[model samples]
Target: MTTPTRPPKTRRRPEWLVPAGLIALSLVPIVAGSARLTQLTTGAAVTAENARFFDSPVPVVTHIVGSSVFLVLGALQFAPSLRRRRWHRIAGRIVAPAGLLSALPALWMTVFYDIPTAVSGPGLAAVRLVLGTTMAAAILVAFIAIRRGDVRTHSAWMTRAYAIGLAAGTQVFVFLPYTLLAGTPSPVVYTLLMTAGWAVNLVIAEVAIRRRARGPRRRTGTTVTAAGARLS
Candidate 1:
């Protein structure tokens, strides 16, 4: 009897694509923050109008460092290679706490930090406060979910937290065009743009989660069809 011919191996989609895109999207704010940090370290002249920011800088530093660690390392969690290699869990040990610190500092800044009245709006502050608080809660709940052996719930909650945390990255896209056109948006306009950023990112996150939820069913269907063919 002739040996059975095996089917050609199907090419697996690159699981790194999504995480790579996410990392690229998040780099805008990270690079900009790094540039500013460099300037500060090099003894750049401080403007009188914004002396407070430079003077009491711990919150900004905390926010930047925490955000960098969380977003960059967190994005890697989505890579299949990292997951298979078990590095995702290793990274999560750092990412989870970093996410909490990233969001809580933002909430703290929203509450205690003063913004220039001309550009500051209550609506934006409220948006920041709510998103930041929820992000922190998501991280906490995810941690608890994983400990309880509910991996699905943990994944969902962590995704939500990460979606919220990407607000800064999304904001770059929103503000750049507005700034180019308007030269400087009013407080109301600024609030709307920032809100749009968070809204868009969350929407994308939800869509991605839905698609992921459907993937297993699709694979199962394929497996069943192949088995039936073999029996026939």
Candidate 2:
């Protein structure tokens, strides 16, 4: 008698893993921002860095609120289960506008405000301007793509926008430890850290998008193969 056939091994799809990771990775900025807001409201002893935010609070505050909402809500979109339900669409509505608001105010501040030399140099300023503009454009294009019923394009563009929006979160992880250990870094170091954050997020987003695109093609190939086997 032959031995019993083994059951087929299936790959487990951890769809929620990315979203969970995004939330966890973002906690640093979330906590820091909350503390700053509390301090600002309570008139606590503020440093020069904090005073800059108070000087031109509108754009800074707007960027903080909008980016926070976009990053937090956008993270939910990665959950496949939520995408099937009403959560995705509802979150999309908030995310799109919030992303635009976030990027626009940032661009405005970069263009018009006198950026503190201690915070950023010419290199970092230019990078932020370009990234801020691109993020805004990505959000707008994603909105148009969805309106035109191009779900794939919409998803790709939104992924890009979300990646840019999360750059701040990534930067926190990159520079916060160093800053704590050695105090504020030089402008060159700051620029490098900022660039690293953007690069890392964009690379990850591209990989995720490519993997998502391949999934449908893989399934179609499997279906066609099964049909051919049946005919044989």
lDDT (Cα, 0-100) at 119 in candidate 1: 49
Q: For model 2, what is the C-alpha lDDT against the true structure?
A: 0.82
Clashing pairs in 1: none
* CA RMSD of each candidate after superposition: 4.1, 4.2
Cα error, candidate 2, residue 48 (Å): 2.7
Q: Model-by-model lDDT, in order?
A: 0.81, 0.82
For residues 33-53, could you state the per-residue lDDT of candidate 2 as single tens digits?
677677767887757666766
Q: Which segments of candidate 1 are over 4 A away from where they belong? A: 1-12, 219-221, 224-232
RMSD of 1: 4.1
lDDT of 1 by residue, 1-232 (tens): 8765555455777988989988998898789779767756787777754554577678777888899899999898888678667777889999999998899888887788776766466588888888999999999999999999887788888999999998888988998998998788887888888899999989988887776655533232134241224321
Cα TM-score of candidate 1:
0.85
